[model samples]
Each structure stands twice: as C-alpha cells, then as structure tokens.
Target chain A: MPLAKRIIPCLDIKNGTTVKGINFVELRDAGDPVELAAAYSKQGADELTFLDITATHEGRKTFVQLVERIAAHINIPFTVGGGIHELRDVERLLVAGADKISINSAALRHPELITEIADHFGSQVCVVAIDAREDDNDWHCYLNGGRIPTAHKLFDWAHEAQERGAGEILFTSMNHDGVKQGYALSALRHLHEQLNIPIIASGGAGTKNHFVEAFEQGMADAALAASVFHFGEIPIPELKSYLCEQGIPIRKL
Target chain B: MNIVILKYNAGNIRSVDHALRRLGVEATITDDHDLIRQADKVIFPGVGEAKYTIEYLRNHGLDKLLLELTNPVLGICLGMQLMCSHSEEGDADLLGIFDQKVKKFQSPSTDFKIPHMGWNTLTDTKSPLFEGISDNEFTYFVHSYYVPVCEHTIATTDYIHPFSAALHKDNYYATQFHPEKSAGVGERILKNFLAL
Candidate 1:
C-alpha cells in the first residue's frame, strides 16, 4: 500500500482556545478547537494535529480536556503534542481520543520514550517531533519547545528514532517557520531521502503550490502548516484539490 | 451495502472516510465484527507499529475475525504491513493472511531512510488496482518496514530496492500506501477495490 500525500492543519492551542500566529510567537485566538477541528474534518484534511504551544512545563500543563474536546466533536484522527513528557502522557492522550501523540522536546531528551510508546501503543501511533534548523552546514536539532539545542544532528536523530521504532517523523524547520515563504525543501529532501519513515514537513508553507513542492520536490509524505490554516488562508479541501490538479496523487476528499 | 471501516486502535480512519465520501462511498468505522462482516466492502487501515496493532486487534479479537473475512478487504499503509506474516518492527507476528514477512528497509549505519515516505512507482505487476495505473506512476509511501515480494505481489516499487506495492491473496488485498490520501490514481484503485 502506498502512503498518500497528507495535507494537515495544525491548531496551536493555548488555555483551551485554538490559536495561530507565526513562528510560535504571536498569540492570536482563532476559535474553539472543536469547531476548527470539525471544519478541517469536513474540508478533507488527511489528518489534524493540535500542538499545545502554550502548554509548557511552566506555562499551563496537560491537554487532556482539549484533546478530548477535539476527539469527541470530530471523528478524524488528530495528533496532540506539547508537554508530552512520559508514557503516561501517551496513555492519557490516547484515552482522551488522540489518535496519535507527537513528542517534541521529550523525544529528543529521552529517545527511549519512543520505544516505550512503541512497546505500548505501537510504532504508527508514536510520532517523533523534530524541530530542526539548517545552520552551520548540517541540520541541527532543537529541543525544549524549540528553545534549547542538542548535540546530535538531525540525520542522526532520525536514523536513531527509526531504530527505536518511531513510525513517523514530524519534522519542522525553525528557519522557514512563520515566514510562509515555502517549505524548507532542502531540509525536507535530506530527511525524505535518508529516513525510511514518513516525514511530515512542517513550517514555511505559503500557498497551495508550497504543498506541491513539499510533496513533489521536497518529497515529504505530508505537508503541515499552522498559520495558513488558522487564518483561513488555505482550506484543507482546496489544497488537496489543487494537488490533485497538479497530478500529485492525493486521496480525493 | 454500506462500507464499514474497522476502527480498533489505528490512526487515519477519518481521512479515509472523508476521502470515500468525496468519492460518493458511504463508510462507517466500527470494531463490531457483525457490522464489518456485513458490509459490502471492509477497509482496515492504520499507521504505527505492528505488535501493538496485533494486540489491539486481539483486544477486540479483530485479528482472528479479519482472517475469516470473505468479503473484499482493503488494507492501507500500515494496514497492509499488519496483514503480512511478520514485521521486524517490534518483531511481532502479523495476521499471517498474506504469508509475507516484513523486514527493515534502513539500518543504523545505512544512508537509506526508514519509513520510505513520498511518491514512487509500481514497476512490475498487473491487477485490478493497476487497471488504469501505469508504469513509472508514483504512489505515496511512508513506512520503514516493508513486506517483501511474494506470490501475492500484485504490484511492486523500488525505494532502495524493488518491494511489494500491492499484495493480494484470495479475497484480501492491501497496499503499503494510503489510498485514502492518494489522489486520482489512488482513488481509482480504491474505486476498483470497491467494485471488486
């Protein structure tokens, strides 16, 4: 079975409200998570991902209720990330109806966490959260909500995670994030070619054509964006239709 | 008859339902064996690891039930891998319906990536899935573990090397890629599967 190109809408939630801005800095309230998630589901996004950008170790804490709201209201599979620190977090997310849990800072810190999740939930359900930056020559790893830097390079982490049994890699580029210029195609190609897992390219998606680049040029399994989705700049269904027009072989929605 | 999608503990079903609806097929997701077995077509799709999937299916006894399916059953992406004999991912025994084994595509030292995500072609094979499908045609893929070419290999694609793209044994048919997310060619395959 071939994996289909996915157009995902990222809802950055803060204190139960769905919000989106740029580069994880500007704080603009979009609406209710349930409402936004329902709309995306209706629009034919392959999947919906909710990142609690505000739910940090000190910011708010836990997104059980928010995840439950999205899961209960909408039937589509949505991944929840941010402040996910342990196996318990994975269980809680699953119990709350999150079909997948994405670990950003946590996975980088504790690579074994991926194995624990795979041991319990399965590799497909456990997605490694990679916040990357193309600096100094090679791709660098970022952690602590994309704040702290790690020693191991991205290619290393990617290969390690796959060995550790991560089913998918959700890779976001800090360079193109919030810019809307386009996806970091070079970074995407590196990950897309080197890793055997599905890489969902995040950051720097300005238009429908940007998605095409992510799929066609970048070779990403899926293209992910937050601002464009929150601002209604691009609808999920519209993007998929556009990709179909380009003959990219997306699941018709 | 209405289509029923098995929803045990996998990811990406809603997208499949949405895509099917877009194609004018009504689909309902349920773990209820009675409901699934009665459907005109049953879709069993998922993402993630294999061992836990088998357990999830075993939890609801869906593993055994899926083997008994006589109706047309379509497995997508991870769904296809789980339908095989076994997978290096978690080294778990799969449903064994396809009599094919899953192996790792990448290594700790090898440069080839795992999860093989993106569009590649089905090189050699013929089937209803490829009715209008062509050689050099690309379909999206995202998995590290792949089911090798076997007697059931209906279509094949090369990532690091050629591997099974579509597998069929008896009434069971599966693809290592997501048809729900695949565009026209993928939709054509799904439509063909439904027609089967």
Candidate 2:
C-alpha cells in the first residue's frame, strides 16, 4: 500500500491543559493534554500536534513537563509548537521526547535558525509553520499569532524555507482558521507545486469532505484541525471510514 | 531481561527509551561497550545523519563492539541505514551487516514526496520480528534514504518502489520505520524482538 494521508488532531495547550478557541481567542478548557493525546492515539490519529498557547517563562517550563507526560503515554508521532525561539528551545523539546518541533515566528525572524536546526538535528526534526492570511489575491505571512504582518509573502517565504532545509511546511490559512469553511486549496496546491517537502494543510477543516479536498485538491500530505476533533464534531474512526469509502487511502483502526 | 539502547550523537534516543517504558521494560540508554555486551538484548536506535553517526561509532569503538555482539540487536531508521555496506548520504561507508547500500529516494514524479513521511504498509514480511504482525501492516516512516530490497530483506514496503522495511541476518535485525512511534503494530514488533 502507498503512504496513507495523515489526519493530525491539533491541541492548543495553555500552561499544562488543552484549550480550544477561535482565531487564538475566546479560549475554553478542553481536557488534560496527556489524556487527550492518549485518546487521540487510541482513536487512530495518524499524528498529534500540540501548540503551546502559553507565552510566559513559567508556562514554557510547564509545557515541557506536559510534553514529557504526553511522550510517556502516546505512541504515535507528534509535533510540539509555540514559543520555540532558539536552537536550545528546539533541543529542549526534542529531548523531552517530541518527535518534531514547529517554529513560526522565530523562523520568520531568523531564517538561519532553520538551517541550524536541520544541520544540528537532521532535517526531519524541523517543521516550519507559516500562518498567513489572504489579502485580495495574495497571502501575507503573519507574526505573534497573526497580530503582526510581515513583508514576506506566502510563496516567497515558503520557497525560502524549503531551501533552508525545512523538513515539512505547515501552512495554516489565517482567514480559514477558526472559520472552518474549508482550506485554501489554491495556495496549498501552489505550495505543492513549488516545494518538494511534505506540506501539511491547516485550518478550515469543518467537515470530512474538507479533509478530502485538502488531500485531493490541495495536494497536502496531511490535514490538521483542532475544534472539530476536540469538540467531537467528527470522530476520527468514522472520518477514516468516510475517507476510505471516498477512495482515499487512510490507516484503518 | 536486561536491555540496553546503544546511544550515540543522534536524535530520538529518548523516544526509544519512552516506548520501551510504555511496554513495561526499563531500558538503560548508554554507549558503554561492556554494558551493551552484557545486556540480553540491545537496541541500536537512532534518527540522524548516517555520516556523522558512523563516524561517532567508529571513534568510540562501538562499530567493532556492535559487530562482535552475539545476542539479538535491533536498529531503527538511521541505525538501519548505518548497518548497510554504504550510504549515498554523505558518501559514507557503514557496517556491512546487511550487505546492501542505502540510496536517497529520487522523486520519480511530482506526486511522490520525499522523506516518505507518513504511515506505510509492510509486505512480504518473514521474520520472528513480525511474529504477531500481519502482512501489509502499517508502520510510521520518516526518511529520505532507503535500503533497496535484497536477499536479507525480511519485510518490504513500496514507496517509489519496493524497499527493505525490515532486514535480518544472523542475530542482527534492522527496520527502516520508527516502531517506537508506530503505535500498536510497532508495540507488537518490539515485543517480538524482545522475545527473540
């Protein structure tokens, strides 16, 4: 069988607990990170991602502890993001048993960090996540959780990141994030065309068909979402069955 | 049983330790040659560049120590690649346990992604390592280079084409996939390895 399209359930974690909200606001408690992670793994989630929504020094320490706990319990591959500033931070997270670390703002500010990470810990350990919003017809990259915009356009930055040795591109459409209509297929398709590494489509995953479109149309290697899976809007087993029925290759439980 | 995870300058060693802990086995992570030789089983697990890792092994005398071990040994991902005779990555020579060469995956077309970075199935499996595992069972993989199917191949997985998913010769065993991160099927594979 060919490689199955990955279905990753993302958890936005604050302090030490999982939280879900819209556009990174209106936060609400979901559940414990370790328990939720084990549940998702049992439900046949291809992979799991945890974004440390907490932004303080204490919170960062707490997040590391949480990562260790999740790693001790969950058996599937997982990526941890949020507040990854330097090579030391990446090293800390990986040492804590994270399979991969996602860097967004820090990567944009210092592109050399990508090369440093890849060179030091192999390319597979570095995941460059880009949070961008579509403006008119172009997509502009954002900083500080989409509050600040940068001069780096979507395609240009993504191309540059691939050149700098990013193992994968996590492209999250800020406009589609939290809205849950669908993914930005055209942009994702463009990324798939321009880059050689795997592209993970994030945001705007409201329904199972949205996932289908992301993989089939967007040409994404994986589709990631939060609220839908967190709130039980779409159970993973049923979703995998649906994708299988739709003729899409998926890992059955 | 005493198990030691041979450690070197590589990533994901802690992950291997964590996976074993979940299975109720507390493995000692070390590079000590005496400890590795004394253990009932040794896991040579790594996720890093083959060039530097092989160099590290040679410098620390692990390259020779590993070859002399008579007990069962399991290598994962980069560890498996280093067990081959040669690797195109960094143009390095490695331990020739498998009598094969590791080649980087060239995308035949745009549809096939490099790194093969997701779940894939194993076919033609024929080893005690896959005792309880069925044919075409899925395992997690994340690597750009692969060992082509050969006489020593115990299991095969097709990405660009058929390649060695698992290899066995004598007491030396290796897998290109990360069983530590492959969930249930992976756990079964590890249990089989321990039993061996």
Candidate 3:
C-alpha cells in the first residue's frame, strides 16, 4: 500500500489556552493544550498542528512553554505556527520542541524567507501556509489570520512557494473555514494537480466522509480540521477506522 | 550503556532527545570526536543539506572519527543519506560507509510529490532494528532524496519506486525515515537498536 493519508487535529491556542467559540464548548471545557495534545496522540491522530493566535509577547512566551510541555507528553510530530516572523523565532520554537514551523504572514512580507529557511533547515522544516478566500471567481491568498488580502492567486502562489522550496503547502480555504460545509474540494483538487509538493487540506471538515472525500476526490495528502476534532463531532480514531474501512489507507490504532 | 547522538547542524535533534528520554534513556547530544568514539552506541541523526553537514563534519574532524568508529551506529534521515558513498543533494561526497549513492526523488507523474513525507510501511524487515516489529509496520518519513535498493538494504518501501528504507552494514545501521518520530513502532525500533 502507499503511504497512509494523514489525519491531523489542529489546536488553536490563544494566550496559552485553546480559544473558545469553536462550537458550544467553552474555553474552560476545552481543556489544556498539553493535555489535549496527549489525548489526540493516544487517540491515533497521525500528527498535530498548534496555531498560536496569541498576539501579546507574554502570550507568545506562554505558547512556547506550552509547546515544551506538549512535546514532552506526545511522541507524534507537531507543528507550531502563527506569529513566526524571523529565523530567530523559528529557532526558538524548534528549540522548544516543535517538529516543523509554519510561516504565513512573514512569508508574504519577504518571499526570500522561504528559500532562507529551506537552505538552513532543509525544505521539510518549512511549511508555507496559504489562507485563501474566493474573490470574484479566482481564489486569492490572505495573510494575518485571513484579515489581509494579497493579489497572489492561490494556484500561482502555491507554485511559487514550492519553487521557493517549501516542503509542503497547508492551504486553508477561508470561505470553508469555521463553516463546516466541507473542504473546498474543487480548489484543493486544482492545487493538488498543479503542485509537486504535498497539499495539506485545511478548513471545513464536518464528517468522516468529508475527510474521505478530501483524499479520494481532492487528492489531498492530509486533512486538517479544528472544531470537529476539538468538539468531539468527529473523534480521530473512529474517523481513521472509517477511512480504513472505506479503502483509504490510514495508520492502524 | 553509553548512548551518544552525534549532533550536527540538524533539525529534529530535540525530538530525538525527547524520544530517548521517554524510553528512560539519557543520550548525550554532541559532535565531540572522543565522546562519540567512547560511546557504546552512536546515533547519527540529522536533518540538513548534505554538503554543509559534510563540511561541518570534516572541519570538526568528526568525519574521520565516524569512519573509524567500531560501535553500533544508527543514522536517521539525512544522517542515513550522508552514510552513503555519494549524494546528489548538493553533489556531496559522504562517509562512504555504505557503497551506494543517494538520489533525489523524481516524480514520474504530475501528482507525485517530492519529500515522500508521511507514514510508510516497511517490507522485508530482516534486520535487528526491526526485531519484534511486524512486517509492513508504518514508520514516519520526510525526505526528498532516497538511497536506491542495494545489497545493504534490510528493508524497502515504495514511493516513486522501491527504495532502501533501512540499511545495515556491520556496525552501521541506518534508516531513511525518522524512526524517532514514528510513534510506538519507532520506540520499539530504537529499543531494538539499543539492545544491539
């Protein structure tokens, strides 16, 4: 069999805790990131992604400490992102025990930073996250938590990032994000067809079938969702079992 | 037992250190020639460009030290690539422990991605590294280059084609994938290596 399609649970961290308003679960009900990470790892999540949405310096330090605590608890690969601007920031995160670092806004601010990171720490360490939204008809990339827009077309920017040596492209459709209407399959398929690098399909995953479609229809190498996995709408183990039963290769529990 | 993880300018070193800690083993992360030579087992794990790592090894006189070591040595990812005679990555000349060449993974189809990233199962698992591990057990991988199947190949995996997933030559055992990051299967593999 080919490599298993990865099932990733994304944890959105704000000020050292998982942000609330992701479904009915309150911030207190969501539990700690470290405990949640350990739970997900045991529950058969292939990997985990932590997006530190904290903007304050104190929050950033807390996120780093959280990463350290989580890294000590889980054995699977974990990626840390959000507010990572410079190489020093990446160094700090990596030292704090992150397996990979995701760059979004800063990657747009200076395109050369992609090549710089790839050259220093191999392309696999560099993940260029493109948060995109459909505008008029064409998908346009956005930065800064999908608040800022750029003229870079989604497909064109994905190709450029690959050329700049990004090992993987975590393409999140802002239109599909938080809506749980399912992934932007057509756009994901288009990017998967165009790029030679792996595509991590992020945003809008509601059910086990949604993940299956992301792999079979969208040709995504991985499917990433936050609220569904976070709020128990779709447990990762049950989801993987469903995918395995549906003829999609996945790691056995 | 003294276990030393030969540290270079590599990513994933911290993860490897943590994995060892989880296994109740304290591994020394160093590039010191004498320390590496004196260790019972040396783990040559790295995640960086071949040419730059080779230059660092030579400048620090660790290249000669590595070539002379008699202890069981395990290499992971770029570490495994560097153990080969040559690498197409930056056209580097490596440690030449294994008489093979590492080549970049070229996609045969438009959909095929480089780096062969994710979990892949291992077949023909005959080495001690895979003891107690089942055939076709999945392990994590992240690399654009691969060591083609040779007599030294102990396990094989298919991506663009069947390639050496694990190689063993005397005291030198290496994995093209990151076993340290491969979950329980990885921990078992590491335990097997230590048992050697």
Candidate 4:
C-alpha cells in the first residue's frame, strides 16, 4: 500500500504552556503540553509539531524540559520549532527528545544552516518552515513570526530550501492563518508541482473538509492546525474516520 | 530486561530511548562494546549516511564487535542497512549480517517520491518481532534505499516494488520502519521485540 496522508496537530507554545490565543480555548485551556501530546498520540495523530512562538534564552531551556516530558509519554514523531538560532539549539532539542527540528527565521538569515544540519543529521531531521503571505499575485516569504517580509519569493525559497537539503517544507499562509476559511490550495498545488519533497499545509483549518481539501486540491502530504484540534472542535479520531470515509488513506483507529 | 540501544551519531536516538521508556524500559544508549555486550537485548537503531556510520563503527572497533554479538539484536533504518553485505549508499560495505545488498529505489515514473516518506502498511509479517501487529497495519517509514526481498525477509512492503520491511537471521532482527515513531502499532512491535 502507498503511504497514508498525515494529520498533524500543532501546538503554539509560549513559556512552556500551550497558548490558546488565536482560538476560543483560552491560555492553558487545552491542558498541559505533555498531557495534550499523549492525548493526541492516543487519538492517532500522525505527528505533532510544537512551535515555541516566543522564547528567551532561559525560556528555551524550559521548552527543552517540556519536550523531554512529552517524549517520555508519547510514541510518535514530533518536531520542535521557534527560536532555534544555532546548531547547538538543534542538538539540544534533539538530545532532549525532539525527533525533528524546524527552523524559519534563522534559516532565512543563514541559508547554509540548512545544509549544515542536513550534512550533520541528514535531511530527514531538518524541516524548513516557510511562512508566506500573498502580495500582488505573488506569495512572499516572511520571517520573525510573520512580521517581516523577505525579498525571496515563496517558490524560489522553497526550491532553494530543498536544494540546500530540507527533507520537507511546512508552508503556512499568513493571510489564511487564524481565518478558518481554508488553506491556500493554489499555492500548495503550485509548490507540490515544483518540489519533490513532502509538503505540509498549515493555517485556516476550521472544518474537517478543510483538511480533505488540503489533500485533494492542495495535494499536501500532511495537514496541520492548532486551534481546531486544541479546542476539541474536531477530535482526531472523528477526523480520521471522516477522512477515511472521504476516501483519503488515513491510519484507522 | 536490560535493554541497550547502540548509539552512533545517528538522529532519533532519543526517540528510541523515549519509546522504550513509554514501555517502562529504561534502555541505555551507549557505544561501549562492553555495555552493549552485557545487555539482555541490544537495539542497533540509527538514521544517517552509511559511509560515515561505517567509518565510525570501524574506528571504534564496533563493526567487529557487532558482527560477533550473541544476544538478540535489533537494527532499525540505516542500522538495518548497515547490517547488509553491501550498500549502494556512499558505496560503503556493511556488516554482512543479513547477506543482502541495499539498493536505492528507482521510480518507474515521476509520480513517486525518492525518499518514500510517511506511513505504509506491512505484509507477510511472520517474525516474532510482529507478534501482535495486525497484518497490513500502517507503520512509519522514511528512506530512499531498500533491501530487496530475500530468504531472510520476514516482512515485506510494496512501494515502487516489493522490498523487505523486516529481516531476520538467527538471533538478529531488523526493521526499515521506525517502530519508535509509528504510534500504537509501532509500540506493539517494539514490545514484541522486547518480549523476544
């Protein structure tokens, strides 16, 4: 059988707690990171991505501890992102139990960082997260939590990222983020056509059909969202069953 | 059980350790031949370039030691590839524990990706390693190269072509998929390995 499409639950963490700002689940509303991670694993999430939206040097250590705690409970792949500035940071997170490391702003600043991590740890361990926003018929890449725009185009940077040895691309549309309308299917389709590596679509996932559209229209390998899964608006088991009924190849519970 | 996870500079070592911990086994991750040899069960898990890994093993004399391990040993991913006689990756020779050749996947068309990432089901799972794993249950896999089916293949997965998903020879067993990351099915497979 062919590989099944993946459903990933993203957690926007701040100061070692799941930040429920964008969605109705207030701060710490979805429970602790380790507890929520275990719940998601039991619900049959393909993987989990924990993004430390804001972190100081001390807060980074706390995040590592959180990763260690989560690792002890769950038995699935999880990626750690945000504030990953150096090779040492990646090393620390991996050693602390993160299966993969996701990088954005640092990668934009020093493209060689991608190659370096790939050379040292293989491409499978490094994920290049591209936050893109539409501007004048062109999707432009952004950095620093989608606040600063870059001169590099989305497709160009994605191509460059793969060339530099990124195993996958996690593309988030800033315009669609928190909007709960739908994914940027056109952008995702364009990327799927251009890149050979796996593409994970992120943002604007409100309903179960939004995920199906990601796979059907966007041709995404995985669909990731935070609020929908965190707030219990859509439980993972029900989502998987829905996707399976929709003829998408999902891991049966 | 005194489980020892042989460590090199491979990625996801912690993942394996964490998996065993979830199973209530505090597996030791060590390269010390003595520690590895003394363990009740040894797990050779790794994900890295074969050439560099082979070089490290040879330099540390682990290549010779692994060839002579008597206890039950389980290899994973690149660890499984390294146990083969030869690998096309980096043109590096391996431990010859399985007496097979590892070759990179050649796509018949452009529709297939090279690495073959994500979850896929396993077939012909006959080894004790998959004692409780249901047939065709999905397991996580991520690799560009694969070992063709042979007498040693205990499980097979079809992608571009049928390849060995799990291999067994006497006391040595290995899987190309990451049981540590395959969720429930994966944990069951790991538990089966421990029971063995």
True contacts kept of each: 0.25, 0.82, 0.75, 0.68
TM-score of each: 0.65, 0.97, 0.96, 0.95
Q: Report per-candidate DockQ.
A: 0.18, 0.85, 0.75, 0.71
Best by TM-score: 2
TM-score pick, better of 1 and 2: 2
Clashing residue pairs in candidate 2 are none
**Residues B54-159 of candidate 4: C-alpha lDDT, one tens digit per residue:** 9999998999999989999999999999999999999999999999999999876435655788889999999989988878899989998999999999999988
Worst 10 residues of 1 chain A by lDDT: A21-30
Q: Count of backbone clashes for each model?
A: 30, 0, 0, 0
Flag the better candidate by lDDT, 1 or 2: 2
- Say which prediction, candidate 1 or candidate 2, comes out ahead on DockQ: 2
| Index of the highest-DockQ prediction | 2
Give the per-residue lDDT digits (tens) of candidate 3, residues A1-253: 8988999988889999887434423344455887777778888888899999988999999999998987777888989999888888988888898888999999988889999888777788889999999978899998788998988889988999999989899999999998888899999999888988899999889888999899999999999988888778888888988998999999886
lDDT of 3 by residue, B1-196 (tens): 8999998877778788889899999999998778999999999888888988999989988889989999999999999999999999899999999999999988987567887999999999888889998888889999889999999999999997899999999999999988888889999999999999
In candidate 3, position B141 carries an lDDT of 92
Candidate 4, A1-253: lDDT as tens digits: 5778999999878889887733333435454888777778887899999999765777777898998998778887889999888898888888888878999999999999999998887888889999999988999999898999999899999999999999899999999999999999999999888887889999999999999999999999999998888778888899999999999988886
Off by over 4 Å in 3: A21-30
Which has the better TM-score: candidate 3, or candidate 4? 3
Cα lDDT tens digits for candidate 2, A1-253: 6899999999888988877642322223336778777778898999999999997899999999999998889999999999999999999999998999999999999999999999998889889999999999989999998999999999999999999999999999999998989999999999999888999999899999999999999999999988888788888898999999988988886
